[model samples]
Target chain A: MFAVHTEDLRKEFTLKKGLFERRTAVAVDNISLTVKEGQAVAFIGPNGAGKSTTIKMLTGILKPSSGKAQVLGLDPWRQRSRLVRQIGAVFGQRSQLWLHLPPKDSFELLAEIYSLDKKSKQYKSRLEMLIERFELAAFLNTPVRKLSLGERMRAEIAASLLHRPRLLLLDEPTIGIDVVARQRLRELLAQWNREEGLTVFLTSHDTGDIEAVADRVILINHGRVIIDDTIDGVRHYGAPKSADTGEPPDMQSLPALEKVLSDLFTAK
Target chain B: MLKTAQKLIAVAKISARANLAYPGEVLGRGTFLLVVLYIFLKLWQATYSESGQSKLAGLSLAEMLWYLTITESMWMSAPKLAQQVDEDVRTGSLAVKLIRPLSYPLYCLSANMGERLVRFSFNLALGACIALALVGPIHLRAEALLMLALSVCLAFLLDGLGHLIVGLSAFWLEDTSGLYLIYTRLTMILGGMLIPLDLFPGWLKNLVVYLPFPYLVWGPVHLLSTPQAELAASFLELAIRQLACLVALSALVALLWQRALRRVSAHGG
Candidate 1:
C-alpha cells in the first residue's frame, strides 16, 4: 500500500492585485505522485516551487483547489483528525516545543495531547527508546530556550515521534546545524526509516541531507513535478561530463554532489 | 469528552509552567501591581475626602480600594491572547498547530486561561498585601469567597472567549492590535475597571450592566466585597448574567473559529 498518493492534486490561491482586481495563482498545479509504504523520499524544490503547498495538502492543512490526495489510504482533508494521529511532521523553521519549557515537559504534554496513556508499557517504552536513540538525556531537563539549535532539533524530532507515527514528514529538518550535528541527525533519520519501516517524506535544499536520508528524490518546480527518480539517477543526472576522460564528475564528494544539484536546479 | 478535557488540562498545565519559567517577568508584574495599588489608594482617599462622604457608590473607602485591587489585578494579568494569535497567523506558525490532533481554538483558550490564572494569582497576592497595608481589611464572608471563586473562573472563560473572538479576526484583518486595543479600552472604561458601576450615571450604569464587560470585572469583584446576607442573592443574579454572556460569546467564538479555518492560507512556506 502507498503511504501517500496524490492524483493531479492542485492548489490555487486568489491574489488580490488591487481594490477590484483578483487573480488566481496556481501553487500546486496538477501534481500526481505516490510514495510506497516505508519508502524514504525527498521532495526537493527551489523556493516558490510549491513543495510546501503539496505537503500542506497531504497533511490536510490546506484544501486542494482540485484533485484528490490519500495519505495512508485516508482522504487527508476529509479525515484530517484521524489522519493526523498516524502522521508526524516537523517544520524546521517552526517549532512544536514550548519555548520556555524543558523538552521533558513538552514531551509529557505531547503524550497527553496524543492521548497516550502515561503509565502504559507501550508509551513508556517508546519514550525511553526516543530518549536514548535521540541522545536527549543530557539536555532533556533544560529549557528549549536554552538548548543549542542541534539539541533543540533532536528534541523536536523526538517529540514528533512520541506517538509512533507511521509516516513522518520533515521539512528542512537539518537547515541550520553544524556539520557533525547535521550528519548525526541524518544518520538517525536514515536509521529510523530503515529499522522502523517508517515512511519518510523529507524536503531539504541541502544536498547532503537528501543524499544521506532519501532513497528516492522527487523534484518539483512551478507547481509541477519536474523530475522523479532514484537518488543514483538524480546524482548521475547532476554529474557533469569530465573533459579529460569523458567521464562523469565524482558524485561521492559533498561539494561535487552540491554542484550537480545546483546545476540541475538552475538548468530546470 | 473526558479525554478532550485531559488534553486541554495538560496544555494548560504546560502553559502555566512555561509562564513561570521567567521569574524576572513575574517579579516585574508584581512590582507594577504594588505601584498601581498604592496610586489607587491615594487617588480614592482624596476623592472621598473631597466629596465629604465616607462612602461612595454604596462602598466604604476600604471596599472601594479592595474592588480596585481586584480589577487592577485582572487588568494587569490579562494574557496577550489576541496578539499571540495575530503573530501565529502572520508568521504561519498556525500551520504547526493545525496538524496536531486537537482543536486549535480550544488549545489556545486553555493555554490563555492557564497563563492568566498564574499571573492573576501572583498579582492578587501582591495586590492584597498592598491593600491590607493601605486600607486595612474589608468585611469578608465564607460564602462570599465561594461565590467569588466561581464568578472569577466564569469571568476568565468569558474574557478568554472575548479575546479569542478578537484574535480570530486576524484571519481576515491585517492586524488585530487596533481591534484588541479597542476591546481592552472598552473593558476598562465600560467594565468598571477604574470605578464601580454604581458610580456611573443611572442611565449609563443600566446600559453597561447588561454588557459582558461589567461581568468580567465588576460583578465578580463586587461579589467578593458584598455583605453575607446580600451575597447569596446578588451572586445568583450575577452568575446567571455571566453564564448568559459566556453562552453568547462562546457561540460567537465557535462561529468565528469555523470561518477562520477556511481562511487558513498558511502563507509563509
Candidate 2:
C-alpha cells in the first residue's frame, strides 16, 4: 500500500489587495504523486515552489483547493486526527519542544499526548533505542533553551519517533547545523529508513542530505512536479560530462555532489 | 474520553513546569503584586473613613481589602493567553500544533490553565501575606474556603475560554491586541476587579450579573465573603451561572476554532 497518494492536489490562497479587491495565488497547482510504503523520497524545490503547501495539505494542516489526498489510506482533511496518530513530522524551523523544560520532560509529555503506555516493554525499548541512537542521553535533562541547535534537533527527532510512526515528514531537518552534526543527522535518517522501513518524506535544499538519505528525488517548481527519479538519475541527468571519460563528473563526495545539484537547480 | 483528559493534563503539567523554570521572573511579579495590594489597601481605607461607615456594601474595611486582594491576584496571574494565540496564528506556529493528534483548542486551554494556576498560586500567597499585614485576618469558615476554591477553579476556566474566543479572532483581525485590551478593560470594570459588584449602582449590578464578566470575578469572590449559613446557597447559584457561561463560551470557541482551521494559511516553509 502507498504511504502517501495525491491526485491532482491543489491549494490556492486568497490575498486582499485592497478594499473591494482580491487576488488568488495558486500555491500548490494540481500536483499528483505517490510514495509507496517505506520509500525514502525527497521533496525538494525552490522557495514558494509550494513544497510546504503540499506538505501542509497532506498533514491536514490546510485543506486543498481541489483534488484528492489519502495518507495511510485515510483522507487527511476529513480524518486528520486519526491520520496524525500514524504519522510524525518535523518542520526544522518550528519546534515542538517546550523551551523552558528539559527534553526528558517533553518526551514524557509527548508519550502521554500520543497515549503511549509509559511502563510498557515496547515504550521502554523504543525510548532506549532512540536515546542510544540519537545520542540524547548526554543532554536529555538539559533545558531545551540551553541545548545547542544540534542537540535540540536530535531531541526533536527522537521525540517525534517516540510514537513509532510509520511515516516521517521532515522539512530541512539538517539546515543551520555544523557539518559534523549535519552528517550525523543524515546518517541517522538513512539508517532509520533502511532498518526500520520507515517511509521518509524529506524536503531540503542541502544536497548532502539528499545524497545520504533520499533514494528518490521529487523536484517541484511553481507548484508542479518537474522531475521524479532516483538520486543517481538526478545526479547524472543534467550534470556536465567529464573530459576524461565523457561521463558525469565524479560526484561521489558531499562537496562535489552539492556542486552538481546546485548546478542542476541553477540550470532549472 | 479518559485518554483525552490525560493528554490535556499532561500538557498542563508541562506548562506549569515550564512556567516555574524562571523563579526570578515569578518573584518579580510577586513584588509587583505586593505593591498593588498595598495601594489598594490604602485607597480602600480612605474610602471607608470618608464614608464614615465601618462597612460599605456589607463589607467591613477588612473584607473589602481582602476582596480586592483576591481580585487583583486573579488579574495579575492571568496568562497572556490571547497574545499567545495571536502570536501562534500570526507566526504560523499554529501548524505545528495542528499536526499533533490532540485538539488544538484543548491543548491551548490546558496550557493556559496550567500557567495561570502556578502564577495565581504565587500571587495569591504573597497577596495574602500582605493583606494579613495590612488588615489582620478576617473571620473565615472552612466551608467558605471550600466554596472559594471550587468557584475560583470555575472562574479560571471561564476566563480562559473568554481569552480563547478573543484570540481566535486573529484568523480575521489584522491584530488582536486592541480586542484583547478592550476585553480586559471590560472585565476589569464589569467583572468588578476594581470594586465589588455590591458597590455598583443597583441597576449596573443587575445588568452585569446577567453577563459573564461578573461571574469571572465577582461571583467567585462574593462566595468567599458570604455569611457562613448562606455560603452553600450562594455557591449553588454561582456554580449554576458559571456552568451556563462555560457552556456558551465553549460552544463559541468550538465554532471559532472550526472556522479558523479553514482560514489557516501557514506563513512560511
Candidate 3:
C-alpha cells in the first residue's frame, strides 16, 4: 500500500516577460521521492517554493510537466476520478464546500458527487461521528459563509472525510486558526490516522502543524528539495539556533516569507 | 436530476435571503432600471407625439411601453454573463465541481438558472404589474403563448452562451471581465431591449436576423404578434441557429477549460 511515489516529477510555467527576460519559470523542478503507507509527511517551504505545485501534481489537481507520479497505486493524473475517491484534499486558500448552503448540505452534496447512497448507514454513522468529534453540530445547519473560520475548517475536514478515505492531503490546514483550534485539528488528524490507518500529507508554515502531525519533512526551496529527511534530521541539518529573544536572525532583518524566498532564489 | 433541481431551488431561495441582506443593492438596481425604463418610455412617447403618430406594427403606445418594460427587466435578469463562472476558473473553484459526480456545466447552468428564475419572477411581478396598471393587459394570442415559452427558453440558452464564452476565455486570458462587459453591452444594444428591432432600418434588421442577437428579445416579442406560417419558419431557424451556437461554443469552452487546468497546475494556481 504505497501512499505516494514520484519519478522526476517536474512542472514548469511560461514566463510573462518583456523582450529580453527569460520566457519560463520552473515552478517544480525534477524530483523523486516516496512516502510509505500511513506515514505523516510534511512538505515545508516558503511560498512559491514548489510545495503547492508538487502537491497539486500529487493530488491530480494538476499534471506534471516532464515526469510521472503515482498515489495509492494509481497514476494520479491519468486516473483522477478513480484516485479521487480514495483520498481527500483540503485547500485552505479555497474551498470545495458550497458557500450558500449549510455544512450538512455540502456534505450531502459531496456524498452525492462521490455517488454514495445516502441510506448507507455505515457512511451515515461515520459522518455523524465526524460531525460530533469536529464539534460541527452547532453550525451543521448554518450556511458555510456564516460559520467562523475555525468552524468552517472543521466542517471542511468533516466533509473531506465522509467517505473514509485512506489518504488525506491538507494544504495550509491550520492557517488562520487560533492556537486551540489548530491543536484540536492536529489531535483529530492523529486519532483518525491511528484508528483508521489513514495517511496524511500536510503542508503548512506553522511549525506546530508539522511537529504534531508529520514525522518526515520534505523541505523545498526554489522548486527543488533542500532536504527530505526525518524531522530531527531536518532540525540537525542547520536550523538557525533561536536568538535568546526566540526569533531567527533572518526574521529580525528580513521583510517576510516572500522576501526570504526571493532572497533564497536570487542567491541560489 | 431531482436533487439537482432541488439544489437550484435552494440556490434561488438562498439568493432571496441574500437580497434581503443587501437591501441597498436591490433598491439601487431596481430604481436604476426603473428610471432608465421611464426615460425610454418618455422619449418614445415624445418622438411619436412629435411626429403626430399614433401606432405602428398594430401596436399602440401602451403596448410598446409594455414591451420596453419586460425587455428591461429581462435585461437586468437575463441569464448571460454568469458572474460566478470567471471566478470559478480564476480562483480554481471549479476544482470543487470537478471532484463532484455532478456534471460541471450542468451544475453551473442550474445555479445560474435558479438566479435568473428569481429575477424573472420578481420582474414579472413588480415590473409587469406596474406597467399593466399604467398601460393594460398584454394580449397574448394562443400561438404567441407558445412562441413566448419557446423564445424565453432560447433566451436562457443565449444567456448561457454569453457566460460560456467569457468563462471559457478565462483559461486563456488573465483577466476576462472587460471582455465580458463589452460583449454584454453589445447584446443589450442590439437585442431589442434598448429599442424595438423593427424600428431599425430594413437592412440592419435583416443583418441581425442572421446573427444570434435578435433571438434574445425581439424574436420572441415579434412571434407574439406575427402570423403562424412566418412564426414557424422563424422559430425553426432560431432553434437551429441557437443549437448550432450552443454546440460550437460548448466544444470551445470544454477545450479551453481543459487547457486551463493544465496551465494552472503547471503554474501553481
Candidate 4:
C-alpha cells in the first residue's frame, strides 16, 4: 500500500465576518499526489502556499474541504490515534518540549505520550544514549528554554523520533538552523532513511533541506501541486537548459534550485 | 489508569514547582488584594454605623465586612479557562494539546484546579492577616462555621462551571473576553459579589436561588451572615442546588468539548 496518498485534496476556511463580506480562503486548493512506501517526498512551497495546511490536514489536525487522503493506509482524520502512532512529526520553529523542563525530561514526556514500551525504551538510559550519539551530553540537565537555538532544535528532533516511527513528517525542519546542527540532522535522517528505510514527507522553503534529505520533490503553489518529480527531474522540467551541449542547468547551487521554484510559481 | 493519574499528578506538581520560582509576583498580588479588602472593611463599617440599625439586612456590621473581604479575594481568583482557550486558538498552539493521548478539557481542568488550590492557600494567609489585623475576630457558630467550609467548596465548583461555559464560547467566537466580562458582571450583581443576595428583592432572590451564580457568593455569604440555628435548614437546601449545578455543568462541558474537537479536526485554528 502507498505510505501516503491524497486525491483532489482541498481545504477552505470561512472568515468570521458577516455573510455580506463573503470572505473565503482556499488555503489548500484541490491537489493530488501520492508517495510510495519508503519513499522520501519533499513538499516545497512559498510561505503562504498551503504547505503547512496540507501537512496539518494529513496529520488529522485539520479536515480537507474536499479530498481523499491516507497515511499508512489509514484515513488520518477518521483514525487519528492509530495513524499518528505510525507517524512522527516535528513542526519547525515550534518546540514541543515544556520550556521549564530539561531536555531529558521532555523526552520522557514524549515517550509517555507515544506509549513506547518502557521495558524496551527505558527513557533515562535510551534518551541519554541518543543524546550521547549527537554529542549533546554536556547539555543534558539544561532547561529547554535556556538552551541555545541549535541545541534546542536537536532536542526537538530527537524528541519526535523517540518512538522510532516508520513515517516522519517535518514542516520546515531546518529553516534557520546553523550549518553544524543542520549537518547533524541531515546525517541522522540519512541513516534512518538508509537503514530503517523510513518514509519522510517534509515541507521546506530551504532547498538545502530538500536536496540533502528528500529523493523526490513535490512543488506546490496557490494550493496546487504544479510539479512532482525527482531532483534531477526538477532541473530538466522546471529549469532552463545550459548552453553547454544543451544540458540542463547545474543543480548543486542552492539559489539555482530556488530560482527554478520562483520562476515556476511566478508564472502561475 | 493509575499511570495516567500519576502522570497528571506529576504534571500538576511540576507545574507548581515551576510557578514557585516566581514567588515575588504572587506575594505582590496577595498584598494588593489584602489592601483592597482592608479599605472595604472600613467603608462597610462606617455605613453600618450611620444606619443606626442593630442589623442591616440581617447581618451585623462586622459580619458584612468579613463577607466582603472573603468574597473579594475569592472572586478575584476566579478560574481562568476562557483566557487559556482564547490563547490556544490565537497561537495555533492547541494543535500540540490535541496530538497528545489525553483529553484536552481534563488537562485544562487539572492545571487550573492545581493552580487555584495554590492561590487559595496564598490568598487565605494574606487575607486572614489583613482581616484579623484590621477587625478583631470574625465570630462563627459551630453550624455556621461547618456550613461555611462546605459553601467555599461549593463556590469552587460553581466557578468551574462558569469558566467552562465561558471558555466553550471560544469554539464559536474568536475571543472570549466579551463573554468573560458579561459573566463577571452578572455574577457580581446576581451572585452577590457587590450587594448581598438577601438585600435583593424577595422575588429576585427566589429566582436566583437555584442558579450557580448565587452558589458562588450567596451560599457563602448567607452561611457567614446567619446564626447556627438558621443555617442548619438552609444548608440542606443549598447543598442540593449546588450538587445539581455541578452535574449539569459537567454534562455541558462534555457536550461542548465534543463540538470543539469536531470543529478543530475539520477547520484550522
Candidate 5:
C-alpha cells in the first residue's frame, strides 16, 4: 500500500463582507497524488501555490472539501489522532515547544503525550540516539527562546520524531537557516531517509533542499500538479540540447538545474 | 483514562514550569494588583462612613473588604485564554497544536489552569497581606474556609470555560479582544466583581443569580464571607448551581470547538 494517497481532494473557503456580499476562494483544487512507502518526495511550488494546503489536508490539520485522502491506509481526517501517532510534522516558522522552557522539558512532555514507556531501555536508547544524531546535547538545556532559528528548527524536528513516526511531513523546513545549518539539516534528513527508510513528504522552495534530499519531485502551481518526475527527469527538462544530434542536456552544471526550475516556475 | 490523565498532567506541569521563567513579570503584576486592593479598601471605608451605616447589605465593613479581596484575586490572576486563542488562530500557529494527539481546547484549558494556579497563589498571598494591613484580621471557621476553597476551584473552571467560549469566537470574528472586554465588564458588574450582589436591588440580584456570571465570581466570594452556621446550606445551594453552569458551559465549548474546526479546515489552517 502507498504511504500517502489522495484522490481529487479540494478545499474552498468563503469570505463575507459587511453586508450581503460573499466571495469564494479555491485553495486546493482537484488534486490527486500518491507516494510509495519510503519515498523521498519533494513537493515544490511557488508562494500561495497550494503546497502547504495539500500537506495540511493530508496531515489532517484541514479537511478537504471533496474527494478522499488516506495516509497509511487510514482516512486522514476521520482518523486524525490515530494518524498523527504514526506521522510527524514540522513547520519551520511555527514552534511546538514551550518558548520559556528547555527542549528537554518539551521532549518529556511529548513522551507523555505519545504515551511512551520512558523507563524502558528501548525508549531510553532511542532518546539518547536522537539527541546524539541531532547534536542537541550542547543546547538541549537552554530555553527555546534563546536558541537561534537553526537550533530551534532542529529541536522541533527532534521532538516530532520522538514518537517514531513512519512518515514525516515538513513544510518549508529549510526556509530561514544559514548555509551550514541548512546543509547539516539536509544531511540529517537524508540519513533518516536512507537508513531508516522513512517516507518523507516535504514542501520547500529551496533548490538545495530539493537537490540534496529528495529523489522524486512534484511541482505544483495554482492548486494543480504541473510536473511529477524523478530528479533526473526534472534536471533534463528545459536544458540546452546538443545542436546536431538533439542529445540530452548536460547535467553537470548547477546553473542548468536552476534554469530549468526557474523556467518551470515562470511557465504558464 | 489513566493515560489521558497522565498526559494532561504532563502538559500542565510543563506549562507551570514555563510560568516560573517570568518571575519578574509576575512580581510586577502582583504588586499592581495589591495597589488596586488598597484603593478599594479606602473607597469602601469612605462609602460606609458617609452612609453612616455599620453594615451595608448584610456584610460588615471588614467582611466586605475580605469579599473584595477574594474576588479581585480571582479576577486579576485569571489566565488570558481569550487573547492567547485569538493570537494562535490569527497567526496559524494553532495548526501545529492541532496535529498533536490532543484536543486543542483541552490542552489550552489545562495549560491555563496550571499557569493560573501559580499566579493565583502569588496574588492570594499578596492580597492577604494588603487585606490584613487595611481591614485587620477577619476570623473564619474551618468548614466555611474549606467550602470557599471548593467553590473557588469550580469558579476557576467556569471562568476559564467562559473565556474559551469568547476566545473561540476568533474562528468567526476578526478579533475577540473587544468581545472579551465586554464580557469582563459584564462579569464585573453583573457577576459581583465590583460590589456584592446583596448590595444590588433585589430584582437585579435575583436576575443576575440565574446567569452563569454570578457563579464565576460572586458565588465563591459570597460563600467565603458566609457565617459558619449557614455555610452548609449556602454551600450546597451554590454547588448545585455551579455544577449546572459547568455542564452547560462545557457543552457549549464542545459544540463551538466543533464548529471552529470546520472553519479552520475550510480556511486551510
Candidate 6:
C-alpha cells in the first residue's frame, strides 16, 4: 500500500475582509497524489504555493475542505492520534524541542511523550544509536538555545526519530544551515532511507536537497501538481542539449540542474 | 491511562526545570510578593484600630492577616496561563500542538501547574515568614492544617479553571488581557482576595456564596481560619462543593475547547 494517498483533496480558507465581509481562497486545489512506501519524494514549490498547507493536511494538523486523504491507510484528520503514532514530523521554522533544556533532556521527554517502553533493551539501544548517528553526544547536554543552527537541526531530526515512526514528514528541514551542515543532513537522511527503508516526504527550496535526497520530484505551483517525474527525467527534460551534436549537457553540475528546474517551473 | 499520566508527569518535570533555570524571574516574583505582604499588614492594622474592635465577623486582627496571606498566596502564585495561550494562538504554534498526540489543554495545564507548584511553595514559605513577623502566632491544630492543605489544592485547581476559561476565549477574542483584567478584579472583590466575604454586607456575602468565584479563595481561606472543633463539618461541605465546581468547570472547558479547535485557523503558518 502507498504511504500517502489523496483523491481530490482540497482546503479553502476564509479570510475576513472587513466587518460582515468574508473571502474564500483555495489553498490546496483538487490535488490527488500518492507516494509508495520507502519512496523519498520532494514536494517543491515557490513561496505561498501551498506546500506547507498540503503537509499540514496530510499530518492531520488541518482538516480538508473536501475530498479524502489517507496516510498509512488511515484518514489523517479523522484518525489523527493513531496516524500520528506512525509518523514523525519536523518543521524547520518551528521546533518541538524544549528550548530551555538540553537535547538529551528533550529526547527523554519525547521518549516519554511517545510512551516508549522504559524497561525494553531495544529502546535503550535505539536511543544510543540515534545519539551516536546524529553525533549528538558532543553537545547533547548543551541547552538548545546555545546550540548552533546546524546542531539544533540535527538534534531536531534525532528527536523526531525517537518514536521509530515509519513515515517522516519534513518541511523545509534545511532552510537556514550552512552548506556543509546541509550536505551532511542530506547524506544522513539518504543513509537512513536506504538502510531502514524510511519513507520521507520533504518540502524544500534548496534544489541541492532534491538532488541529494529525493529520487522522485513532484513540482507544485498554484496549489496543483505541475509535474510528477523522476529526478533523472526532470534533469533530462530540462537539460540544454547541443542541437548540432545531439549530446546531453553536463547533468552533474548543481547550477545547471537548478537552472533547468527553474526554467521548467517558469515554462509551466 | 497510565501512559497519559506518565506523559503529563514528564511535561510537568520539564516545565519545572525550565522555570527554575532562570532564577532571576523567581527572585523578582518573590520580591513582589513580600512588598504586597508589607502593604497588607499596615492596611489591616489601621482598619482594626480605627474600627476599635478586636474582631470583625468573628475574625481577630491576627486571623484576618493570616487569611489575607493565604488568599494572596493563591492569587500571586498562579502561572500566566492566559498569556501563554495568547502567544501560542497568535504564533500558530497551537497548530503544531494539535498535530502531536498530546492534548493541548492538558499539556498547557500540566506545564503551568508545574510552574505554579514551584512558585507556590516559595510564596508559601515567604508568606509564613511575613505572617509570623507581623502578627505573631495563633492557635492551630494538626487536623486544621491538613484541611487547610486540602483546601489550598482545591483552590489551585479552581483558579486554573478560571484562567483556562479566559485563555480559551482567545480562540474568538483577539486579546484576552481585557477579559483577564475583569477576571482578576472580580476574583479579588467577590472571591475574597482583597476583603473577606464575611466583612461584606450580608446580602452581598450571601449572593457570592452561590458563585464559583468564592470557592477559589474565600472557601479555602475560611477553611484555614475556621476553629478546630468546627473543622470536620466545614471540611466535608466545602470539599463536596469544590468537587462539584471542578466537575462543572472541566465540562465547560472541554465543551469550549471542542468548539475552539474547529475555529483554529493556524494563521501564521
* DockQ sort, best first: 2, 1, 5, 6, 3, 4
Model 1 regions lying over 4 Å from their true place: A239-255
lDDT of 4 by residue, A27-104 (tens): 889888889878888998776788878888888878788989988898988888787777878777666877876787
Stretches off by above 4 angstroms in model 6 are A236-257, A260-268, B266-269
Q: Which prediction has more favorable lDDT, 1 or 3?
A: 1
Better of 3 and 6 by lDDT: 6
lDDT score of residue B153 within candidate 4:
74
lDDT of 2 by residue, A61-87 (tens): 999999999999999999999998899
Output the better candidate (2/5) by lDDT: 2
Q: Candidate 6 residues B130-192, lDDT tens each? A: 888888877767787888778878877777877888998988897999999998889889999
TM-score of each: 0.96, 0.96, 0.86, 0.85, 0.96, 0.93
Q: Which residue pairs show collisions in model 6?
A: none
Look at candidate 3 and give me any clashing residue pairs: A113-B101
DockQ for every model, please: 0.71, 0.77, 0.32, 0.31, 0.63, 0.54
Model 6 per-residue lDDT tens digits across residues A68-126: 99999999989999998899898887888888889988888888888888679988998
TM-score of chain A of each: 0.94, 0.92, 0.87, 0.89, 0.94, 0.93
- Model 4 chain A: which ten-residue window has the lowest total lDDT? A238-247
Q: Candidate 2 — which pairs collide?
A: none
**lDDT per residue as tens, model 3, B1-269:** 67666555554455444334444655666777667767877887897898787875556788888777777777777654355777777776666556544456666665566566666667656777667666678676787677677777667766776787787677778788788888788778778877788888999888887777777777676666566668788777767777776677677667766676666543332
Q: Tell me the lDDT of model 5 at B205.
A: 89
Tens digits of per-residue lDDT for model 2 on B137-201?
99878888888888888999999999998999999999888899999999999999999998899
Calculate the i-RMS of every candidate, to one decimal place: 1.1, 0.9, 3.9, 3.4, 2.3, 1.9
User: At residue A183, what lDDT does model 1 achieve?
Assistant: 94
Candidate 5, A1-268: lDDT as tens digits? 6999989989777778668999987888888899999999999877877887888888888889999999999998899989999999998788999999999999999999999999999889989989999999999999999998889888999999999999999998988899999999999999999998999888887888998899999988888888999888887676555432566555574245567888888888
